[model samples]
Target: MSYSDTNDPAFESMGNAAHYTNIASTLFFAYAVVSFVKDDANDPLFDKSWKQDGFCVTHKEIPFWNSHDACLYFDMMAALLLGALYWKQRNALGMERVNEIFGPSILGILAHGIGHGAVAHRMREMGLPTLAEEDDLDKTTIDENINERIMEINMMDDILGVGEVSERGRNVFVMVCFWVGLMKAALPNLRMAPFAAMVLAAMAGQQFVDRQFAFTYVQTILLVAFSVNQLARKKEEKDFVYATHPMVVGVPVTFIGWIESTQCSAFVKDSFYGHLIYDGFIPVAMLVWYVVCYLQIKESRDNSFESIAKTADRKGKVKVS
Candidate 1:
């Protein structure tokens, strides 16, 4: 039996409009980050910022006013908006479709975390004080000017750090919802809620405690489980299979990033090639993944709900006849 076209027109129109809008938004977000990497044209914007003496984006003079800091702020908001947009369309979309929009955004968030960690280390190497050190200042002995400067740096660092962590926490929530939505869209009968909740809790705990290794471990386990779950199905589950790609690819990159952070990997840490690979190349790989996922989703949309309804109707008619 041919699939009914009664609602296909409406659904197709909505999907196509949203699909283009999402692609445009994602490209704009990527361009923003690339533009920042290309030039620090906006550095002049924060010359009068109160905390200009600090070495890191979080500690830079002028709260919320530095070029690098501003990029982070913009990236965070862009990603948050994308995630929220996907959430709003959850019922109308499929698992793979949601991942097509979200997978890259979440990976970018992880990259943002790595970016901050890199900045934190560089600041430490430059002998910059952390927010923790500002408390050691005695209110009475220091000159008013010096005390005020110290307070400013400390406060700015605290605010930026909290913002970073909070952003990651929100990403965790969005990821959990994405997984749940994926399950509902693909494997509707499976009991995946508990597993999804557990995954979220694990990620949130790791984020709160600032445990990157632990978080990575949890992510790895979940990915493997996801892969296994899909393989177990007698019927092929292509979407679930697609879900494993990021997980499998991310583990090695993440481990390398971690290793590069340590003294043991100083050869890679010091070399230009090392910097290129760790800082420049790896993140670009993430951008590539997002672009690929977007294209796949776009190609798959035409055959989605319409195909499902038609297939179901064909079987129903066959049985009746």
Candidate 2:
């Protein structure tokens, strides 16, 4: 069907979601760059106190930016935004679309596990300190932090009916990545190398498919979800503010993921790059997706109001006659 003539409300909703999500993604990207620039201004390397530290802590110890904290915040924001969008546009998009989009989207995020594990393996093989080690922090602490953040971020995924699948898939994907790392470490020339490479390729393809589907799904879901919520609640301002989180978090992450996947595949062999892709990009894309959806929905809403006004004017004239 032609764009305007397309009868499927879900498709229309998807387009709307994409519009809002794009705007949100742009804003978040700008904010992230600004945050990084502000933090980098301290010049930690020149500081004597920084020199006294055992490990090179310039990047980690920057006073203005805590990478881990920023990542957590971004993920949480993305989750909330996803929830808000789904809550508002569930009907127009339909439950099925919601499930399909969310299922693959979550999987796409999980795919980063392979890249993460691969990078860590490469670093260890080359005798470089792994990121977790370089930070002078225990593995347990990082794991705990990740767990907590996962729960927080996955809360919205659960609400939208794809959280469980995605979470399980992520766990599996991570384990696979770990195994790949171990293989790279223990037996770099094993006969299974070709098979392993094939598996990784398949996983990457799956992730891409999931991500693209999820983006479309979220777009469809957000339009109907928000409109329905607004109708029920009658509190537009409060809901709109609440809805902002999805746009802010989802769009940027999605776009970031696309960029990282395309631009940094070479680096994905390193764990740090993997983490950056998984932790950084996914949340950003989701935020972008939400912003795109929001704009379309808003325009649709405006047109609706105008139509209502015109209809009222016509009826008034008829009644007077």
Candidate 3:
């Protein structure tokens, strides 16, 4: 927070770059970890399972920072940093305005971090075929693996297990936060009406659907609306970067995320590297939008003070006196 508050503009950029590099290092480390484990499944934890069940059914996760189970952990850190950034700005921007604009995203990131990291991670303990071998499996074997993969979706629909119920409920809460932010950030228009309604419908029926789909499309929808809003604002402001910079980083990657989820979904589900690139842009997207909102509020405050002049200029305009 103080980093951004300082007069040096490079401070915040440097901090962000450092955090990005740290995460990138973890990802490369994970790839090497995966290679080592598979090359010698003799690691005690996997030795028994690997021998008895073959590599397909043996769990490949490293407890601390595995590919799939660690996103929630990173999400927690991101939420904390994001919260700190907003905390310093809230008072200057007005608490209510900040809450309306930013509070949901901060809470949503934190909430999902806990939900996915703890709850969903536990649900994913069962091993599926590794990325290297998924292509070689026969129909029946592949069918079985597919069922195993859908266990999360099926569990969400069960309504009997208390854990699944709680997890789904938590996801729904995150869904609401996203919807609230979408409403606040995007200017309403007839053009966006149908898309908004469809998202609401999907969200309302999340128990029957894969929660990830809702998240992907919610982002796609929000980004489009956000871009349009920025375009409209650019007309009034005559500042291209102010209106378009957020879109520069967010839109194409999000569209790639959308495509990856729908077309190459199996790859994303099967590979750690795939998930890192496909699903990882999420936090990046959230931060871009948060920055956009911050700039908007600051712009408003700066513009508000310029309309009235000081007494020196008011000397000729003191008709009121």
Candidate 4:
């Protein structure tokens, strides 16, 4: 059947998801760049001393425009946008389309929320204030001395610091990316959903896993498995795009991500450049591939029309004869 004649709602959903995802990816990428840039003073991203008042708007206690919280906020916003887009178009797109687009997303969002909540709980358990509950210290008159409150605020960074929260957000972002990609590829299954979640959990569960690069190794093994599975299911069909086409690319792309994450990749050793190349390369490449695929399909369709016209002309001449 022709592409336009395709009644497959799932295919249409994939198209919509890809359209929005490309935009989301680009926006996130721009933020990622700004987030990774080191200041002239050589302080790490989000590493600033708390104000003497102890709870200013820019304080780390709340989610500021810093690298860590920015990532979390951006991912949450994008995911909500994706869901809203699908929901608003649901009547036209149908149930299969809606489920395909929203299934992994809802799950991924819950996972991220839970991850953040767990960290917050840990912080409170350690006697660290979860967030700045009060307004600016100037607004609220407290009996406690200024120095005591400042000391407490300093401990906030010490106990409930940037590392775990940012790491968790990063893992959630990666998980969401994979989830959306799998949905777009029309490869979402019962197994794949949990597998993606498992990878996310494992990557974030660094405190549990003492071994270095364990997450990378796990991701590498998963990609290989997915590639092999897709290849094994290969079939001969002109109209059908092989799911394995993108699946195979994922194997090498994932390996590149792994390499870039480690110091072993010296040419771009885990710097801002490496992060950009690692995160940005595959999406851009896939986008170019999509455009080429569209052109090829258009050419094939035009050729098909020409062949039909020629056959009809020949038949008409025979009727005249």
Candidate 5:
């Protein structure tokens, strides 16, 4: 089953995508689980994300554990999977793909986890509201301008008011990840697509760091289109699952990501429970992707087929006799 002599150019690409899908799904599922389980009542004041006066803390204040902590742990899981995935593929598919396929996305997500950790630490050190309402803040304890501080989290656009440098740095890095990914893709390097997708995801995302309503739909639709294209292919490779399964995870990830934006009346979109459900879905979607990826890689190793019939299609891959 080793693909050492396979003629398909997509061997490495498919292998790498499966790996990414695994991490992404697990990371996403963690986000969802944490959101559901994090109980303000169970938390001591020190561990909660709100201040004494009811203002929202900018940091993920839990000492040993928090959402960022969950993400880092997931990143560790990703590292392990990456190591295993890399080892298998390099031996079977060839070592030449090691850096070219796996390096950037893995590194990007790791950096993203580090950035989140930094933001959490730095913001906790500052000890002020990154998100707050005027009523939540006490009038007398601090010297910062109240007008500059108060921002309603309920509104989408008001996130602009958060002026923390660490937060901004994280966002800027996310954008940079996407930009670099685009540059790679511009050269027709499809290998980097997952990295760019991670950029938009806030690193192997079950959650978009900055969520937008219509934007979620676009992501969902595009990924679905990708799945459809793979499914419609006239020639199904031995690695057909490799081509389609990763994209299949996209449907639920986008749907879960879209739930918050739905504003459905029955869903209580304005409630804390709603927030928990939305955040919770992030990890669920991620976990789904992980499962698919795991299956894909396992299948690839077991099903490496030789003598692929190179046929022409509308996309313009040249036909071979």
Candidate 6:
């Protein structure tokens, strides 16, 4: 009758981790929002661009500065709310409570995975074109394609009934918002080198330990992978679909960075065996998971085939019935 016997801790830990992540996320986000509100001025980077095609000039301004800001604020708010809920229920909820949060957590993870994955795939499919080539693509066409994909993914979620957005998407949105807000507020003059370093550290932390601990690690890895893959393939990689694609190079690297960050942090720094708990461990774990899932799926298929084949063979042996 004990809760320990009835529920799995692995599932529960995910929820607890997510709850803590939300707490940190909220603090960062609040800082972002207050900073933005106080400094509502626009930067030159936000300027629009114009392209001329024959006699016509097309003008484009990036969408939703305000909306992006709002999303960042709201994402932080959501994280804070989740943190509060976790704090309230930590003692009474047990593993089931943690398990319950997995649905949302996974959804967030998948969202981020797909969004960036798709972008990488698309860039690859586009053949690693120059900025000019990318600009040449009709913005509306690109937007439509993105919208279509988003809709298709949304439908898949609807069928699954897990929640609205995928985990990856939520992660990407929230992380991006956090980064943008941070840049806008505290690090307005941030250089690429320092930004890259932060990204590397954050990525190292997230992949090895937990993503919530440091989200930027994921972004850094994604960008670097995309750059490297474009160089290696000599052709654009395919637009990312759901499965693990060539663009997945980012995942492992970021995971490594995250692990590093976790170990360095105050809470985990002195923990036992912390030295062995680097982000490098993530790849080994992922490889194991991949093999296990593949083997299980293959076994199921093989068994299904055997069952059908046996049934047919039995029927063949029988007289006309």
Q: Output the better candidate (2/4) by lDDT.
A: 2
Candidate 6 regions exceeding 4 Å error are 1-219, 223-276, 319-321
> Candidate 3, TM-score vs. the true structure?
0.47
Using all chains and alpha carbons, the TM-scores for the candidates as numbered come to 0.34, 0.32, 0.47, 0.41, 0.39, 0.24
Q: Distance (Å) between predicted and true CA of 179, model 2? A: 15
Candidate 6 lDDT over 1-321, as tens digits, reads: 222222223423433333334334434433342333223264111111100100010111222211122222333444355445445644542223222322233233333333333333322333432345557677666544433432232222222223345755754554454333332222223467875565445433443522121233333333343333223321122111112211232244334333433233333223422212322232333333333333444454566679999999899889565
Number of backbone collisions per candidate, in order? 5, 50, 0, 0, 11, 36
Tally clashing residue pairs in candidate 5: 11
lDDT score, residue 161, model 1? 43
lDDT by residue (tens digit), candidate 2, 217-290: 33223333333332232232223323433345444444644444333324431434232444655545554644
Model 2 / residue 300 / CA error / Å: 1.9
Q: What is the total number of backbone clashes in candidate 3?
A: 0
Report the lDDT of model 2 for residue 14: 51
Cα lDDT, model 6, residue 95: 26
**Candidate 4 local lDDT, residue 156:** 26
lDDT of 4 by residue, 1-321 (tens): 345322334433443333333334334433332343224254232212211221111222333332223334444554565456545645542234224424454444434433333333333333422246445454223223322443443222332344678855654454455434433233334375766665555434433421222223333334444333334432322121332134223434544543443322344422333233433344344434433444544565577688999999999999999
Worst lDDT 10-window in candidate 5:
46-55
Which numbered prediction scores highest in TM-score against the true structure? 3
lDDT of 1 by residue, 1-321 (tens): 113221223443333333333334334433343333223465322111111222112223233333334444444554565556546644543344335435544445444433444333323333433344557755333234333443333322322343467754654444454344333322323465765665455444434322212223333344344334433444323342244233333334444433433322334423422223333434344445545544455445556767889999999999999
TM-score-superior candidate, 2 or 6: 2
